[model samples]
Target chain A: MALFTEAFLTALLAGAISAGIPLLLVGLGEQMSEKSGVLNIGIEGMMLAGAYTGFLIAWKTESMGLGFLAGAGGGMFVALFMAVLCVRLGLNQIVIGISLTLGAEGATAILHYFQFSRTYPRLPATLKWDIPFLHDIPVVGPALFGREPIVYFALFLVSVFAYLYRRTHFGLALQAAGDKPAALDSSGVDVLKVRAVAVLTTGALAGLGGAFMAIVGAGIFVPFMTHGNGFIGIVLAMLARGRPLWVLGGATLFGACLSLTTALQVAGIDIPTDVIQMLPFAAVMVVLIVLGSKANLPVSLGTAYARGER
Target chain B: MTSEMAIAPDSGENERKSRLNMRDDRLHFLIITIGPVLATLVIASFILMAMGVSPLDYYGYIFQRGMLSPSGVQATLTRMGPLLLIAASLIVCFRAGIWNLGGDAQFILGAVFVAAAGPELVAILPVWLMLLLCLSIGAAAGAVWSLVPAFLRAYQGINEIITTMMMTFLGGSLANVLVKLVFLDPETTVPQTRTLAVSDRLPRLFDTTVSSGVLLGLAAVLIVHFTMNRTAFGLRLRIVGANAKAAVHAGLPVATLTVIVFSLSAGLAGLAGAVAVLGQTGNVRADWNPAYTLTIVPLVFLARFNGFATIAFVFLFSVLSIGSESAARRLGVPNYFTLVTMATLLILMAVAEMIDQRRRKRKEV
Candidate 1:
């Protein structure tokens, strides 16, 4: 009985770590973007685009690290396009973001089709980190220490981001840009540059999240496989209320919810599987409801700043 | 004073002559009617030519193979039916300046609800009555589904775009659940709802393949267009949409209008679902790919807010979709190239608008 219980706990922990990494990366990345007053709702599409690009690059070059960089670069491309629309053109941010999501989705699918036109190539498999001596441990090693280095990197990023946002000059400028771009502008910070860099970096990190899943988790690129994780990141960002530290908590909670849903299905509970699958979304809804009740968006969030206007 | 009055009358005469001259400009009127079609043709031809095919032949083949043939027209009309209905619904909300990105979710919920409700209602009522009940049920479900984001936007001030979009994805999952758990068809190879009863289906329009659903969609469009363009409520919505603060200053009920417009838009989207189940698919199936909600947005926007233009755009898109599939099979081209083409066209259109706005600014300067 103890053996079975330990095995179950090990699987649950493994699932949480695996699932949480992507959310953590995406949420933290999006938090940085939003903190600079740009909402990249296209993150999901960008993730999918990155997944394909990473998979294709890895498939061709047979290099895992190159694939990861390609993924981040692919995401950056889309983010730069969004910056052009939102910052340069002064389009409605939400519409432009959504439109770019649609555009990216269509473009990514086309890219996938063209890449696999001559031959079917599988995603580059992720390498597991076999920690010295830790690999000898029974369940804990496999559950915690056996993940790819990328997973550790993602978790570390969460804390690093939390620290940066909490205590850094650049982070302060980003926050100032989001809440009061005018103040930042007056302070001689190029608000547009700050916002642009923030959005671009968000894309790169989100792309990394996609590469983690496509290369490591599933080892294949599937259409719409990010499966609303990008939106979930948005919800996470909202729940965090732009606090990087809170984002860690929010992402872990979401990841736990996702892991629980999977575990429940495996446990063969009497509850409907769809109802369980819906838990993450339900959690997000609850967060949004609370966030909405609290009215917590930065006062100037989701708006493009026009210079010399009032 | 008498000489100045004489000159004023002459000036008025010149103004009237200029107005009459504008009406006489037939060439300008022709451009307005023929410009979009020409643009579409030119783009389509250029694309076909670039692919090393004769554009004229391809156009002819499409017309002869799809539209001129009975099945072609029937298919076109069949596709047109739901599209027109959905586009009209989209138009209503857009006109009110509310972006309901939740159309897809509303659509899926409507399908799920009708799928669940159709068979039971058929046993209780006659065929036509059952269809009506299913549609009403579907519309109600959509409205209920849409209320979440709409209410959030109105009361809590959440951004409707994300909330609506999130709801759409959730609704899709809910549809999957319905198919997998509630109405899982045991006989099908894939997860899908049970086939609805034949009696519950919409009547065929002709002895041909076309269904009465096409007429119904057209009727809905006409009714909605009238409601939007010719009604006081619609005018109030337009005012509210254009400037909410100004609308309030003008004593228009902006809040009430928002709720009404969103509900109506969602209800219309639900009707689209009902039509799909009753007229086209004859059952709710999870096998349906692509998010219909996202699909409808481009269709509506690409219409540039004209109801008449929406009808044409839907027809054009349906043809492109079917034609692209045929091209994939016959020409060995990637079928999704159609979506790529459509996306490119959309981005181009937006760019064109941006350029136009800039030119206007330059002229003003």
Candidate 2:
């Protein structure tokens, strides 16, 4: 009858990891785009599209791999419009981003209604790989070291992104594209091309994250199931301010907060469910405000680049 | 003497070419305005086909039910009340180059406040006075909700888009909490605020089913349009929006204007919430959001800040929304198809605008 049992605590830790992986993937993707000076507000749409497509593919083929690939493809499909309208055509980024999200939501919802409304199929349990020595440890070992392959891949991406941002010419070009596109252009780099690649890569990563949410986290996809994870990812990326490690930390913190809320509700805490739910959102915002107050964004973050129109 | 003769003939030819370009420009303007709408419809038709529904049948139902039928026309007109008001709110903020994506939050807060306070106030005051107070309270709450992002953008240089959206999420959660926990009508099994009686509600317009809120929305639009176009205060706000540095050099109070613009824009959204409750919904319920804010964004954009054009676009949207509900049921498609169409329209409009800009630049060259 004890509320703070070891089992309960272990479950909470596992839940946090489950919840955090999507945010981490989305944050990393968003960071890449922001680094190239594109604020992709349409990521929510991409995530939703990815979720539906990923879920559909996984359900149809019983292959998680193909599902994830389709999810990324779906996300990239929406991102293509973002690239064309906002990046190539020199339109308003925010407006186009919003339109894409709305469009994606509608498209995915309609697709779900037609294909799966009558019978909402849930996926089988996901396949997880256990690390040799780490899995033998106590509660911490199982919760951290034993996860689906995507979770490990998502975590590994932090280091990969860190390396890309720190020690490469492509990384330098991305930095210059965000900070001073004209200078980058004059230096013989194609600013638009760099931004296009970053935005597309962001779509693929975000789509994968959404697929993870549907295929592994929830084991089922529902309309608007990505919820506000995409927006939360934007916040994480913005607060992290070019630091992939910071994104990892923020995502973990946010995920932990989400678990805490669920734990509170399950324990029959004498508080309104709505207020309890608000905890994660409020906690993330407060932490970001305090820690990221000094974080500086790219100089020309949301502006469209024009070659000679200074 | 030979150079002068050559120049005179060339000048005559250039004049004819310039006149031809002028005529082409007018035709281009017409195409640019209508092209996006047509593109959106065509794209939406493909989506319909994929769903195994005939696009013609769906469009027919929407037009017939939304505009042609008497009852459908009434419903569409009634629906326009909130849509028009929210469009007005968006116009105000977008004109000032501020993106108040928190309109949804402000709107929900306004509705919550009005629903919580209206029933009690009716006991102590006359009906008209009580309604007025409820609206003012709603507007005040919405304005206060927006102040956080406005203050942050004005002083701390934080991006309003992210902050406002976060606030919207917070607002939605808070509204549900208020309904389910704080203001729950004890007699009802459902989680909702105390509903006002019919007598306490806003009277129907001209003995018709349409709410008088539509009239209020129209009045707000006209006043806002005139203020934005005719007044010096409006000019100052526009200058601040057009170029903040130039406004600063002109000695304008940029920060103060930012605050005021946010307040007025949020106040309009708040009023929309109040009107929706008093005129139609009657109370606030848990987990309810009409999502009027985002739906109206594209319409306001297409209208290009013209009040009359906004009214026209709002009418078009209302017809689609009201008409599509039955069509969705009949065609076995989700009602969300309208959102897809609106989003497509917005994207196409942006593309069209870009093309127009390119053409203008070429002409300048």
Candidate 3:
């Protein structure tokens, strides 16, 4: 009859990690894209593509690894459109980004309707890897350490990205590509190439996030399953500026808010569940408004890099 | 909030532009405009073939039921009421270089508000007066929902795409709350807003089944076209769209224009919702989000944000949607194919624009 049992709190924290990992991956990818000056709004579509293909492949092969690969590949496939249209052809980034998402939604829905709508098959439970000594620390350990390998890898990626942005030459080129493509071009780097690679990498990460959502988080793929996670990732990336650690912080905060929503509902809160569900989105909006004005942004963000064009 | 869309691939040059001032040659313009639609049909036919549905049969059925039949024509016209208004809304936003993808949320908010209020007002006021008030309420609700995102984007330099989308998620959830709890009609068997009688709805056109809301939608798009293309205000907005920095340097109120763009576009979208509730749906049901906005996004883009062209595309889309539903029923294929086709058309539209731009540059060379 206790409202906040130890087990309940552990499950809540575990759910936070389950949700945060996808946002973390997506935000990391989106950060790289923004750093390279492409807004990359199509991450939503990429995530959906990954979720569908990831679920389909995992179901067919019964291999989680291959499923994640297919998910990433599917995202890259959608990103190809962004690369060609927005980057290569110099089109509107926002319009193309939105169109790609719409396209992915329709395509995935059709594929799902034809392939899996009848059986509604779901995967088995996600396997967890218990870290020695760490996972025994009661609720915190089980929630943070005794989880899927991808969760650890996603966390590791935060540090990797931190090092990538602050130390590497490629990171400087990326910064140059976003801040001043002309300077990067004068220095003999192809600005378009840098931006293109960044976008494609974004697709892979977003796709993997989608795959994780399906194979590990939900164990099933429905059309539009990614929901607004991709958009949320964009928010995270924008807020992070160029800091992967900040992205992690923002994403975790969002994930914790999601858990809080579930907890409030479970506690028999009088408000409608629909109203309760608005917390994460409302939280993200408030965060964006409060921190957005002061966040440093890429000068060339959302613009196509056309040589010799001011 | 960002100046990244400067001329949308216009090579960073600030130039005066409008429907009247577009300098494309007729052949180039025709190819760019018509190419994507035909290509989309061809690709969609291939998809149909893969599904074992004969393309000929599908096309034949769509044409017969959606266009050649009386009842279908009436239905298509009724569908156009909301779509045409949305097209107008999109034209306004795109013209100002602001993206308002929150149409779905705005539309839902507008429709739910009107549905919740209409019955009470119709009891006290004349039908015509009630309808006007309901539509106004819908528009005001939509504009109000848009204010936060508009303010954030205009004053704070945050992207509206993120803010608008976040608001959309909120709007959907909030509308469900309003409909399921606050607006539930106790007299109804199901949890839904109270419905008005058919006679209380927008009157049909001259004994036909088509609602008079179609005229409102059509007139709105036309007015947008004339105003955006012909008026000094339209020119100022276009100047902001083409180059916000230039507009600012020219002493235009850039932030105000951006907010006005949001209010006008979202207001029209809300009006579309009002028209639908007033003319077609009659009531807001629990968990009903028709998602007509995303479909209209591609349509406006394929129309290149032009008003007259948008009118033509809306009619075609209405027919396609009506026909596709029946075709999907008969062919045992899912009806989502219409969305796939629209999405393909959108991609092709971008490709076509790219080709047109390349050809223009080559000609100049």
The sequence of per-residue lDDT tens digits that candidate 3 reaches over residues B207-323 is: 899999999999999999989878999988888888788999999999998999999999999999898999998999988998888778767876777787899889988999999
Q: What is the lDDT of residue A209 in candidate 2?
A: 88
Say which docking band candidate 2 falls in.
acceptable
Order the numbered candidates by DockQ, best leading: 3, 2, 1
The TM-score between candidate 2 and the true structure equals 0.92
lDDT of 2 by residue, A116-140 (tens): 7756789999888999999988878
True A-B contacts kept by model 1: 0.21
Provide the TM-score of chain B versus the true chain B for each model in turn.
Answer: 0.84, 0.88, 0.92
Q: Write the per-residue lDDT of candidate 1 for residues A27-102, one digit (tens) a residue.
A: 8888888888887777887787777777778777888889889999988888887788777775546545666676
Which residue pairs in model 1 clash with each other?
none
**Per lDDT, what order, best first?**
3, 2, 1
Q: Each prediction's Cα lDDT score?
A: 0.73, 0.84, 0.86
Instruction: Tell me the tens digit of each residue's lDDT in model 1 across B178-292.
Output: 8877787789888777778655688887586676777877887778778766788777777666666677899886777788888999998888888888887877777463455
Which of candidates 1 and 3 reaches a greater DockQ? Answer: 3
Question: Considering summed lDDT, which 10 consecutive residues are worst modelled in model 2 chain B?
Answer: B1-10
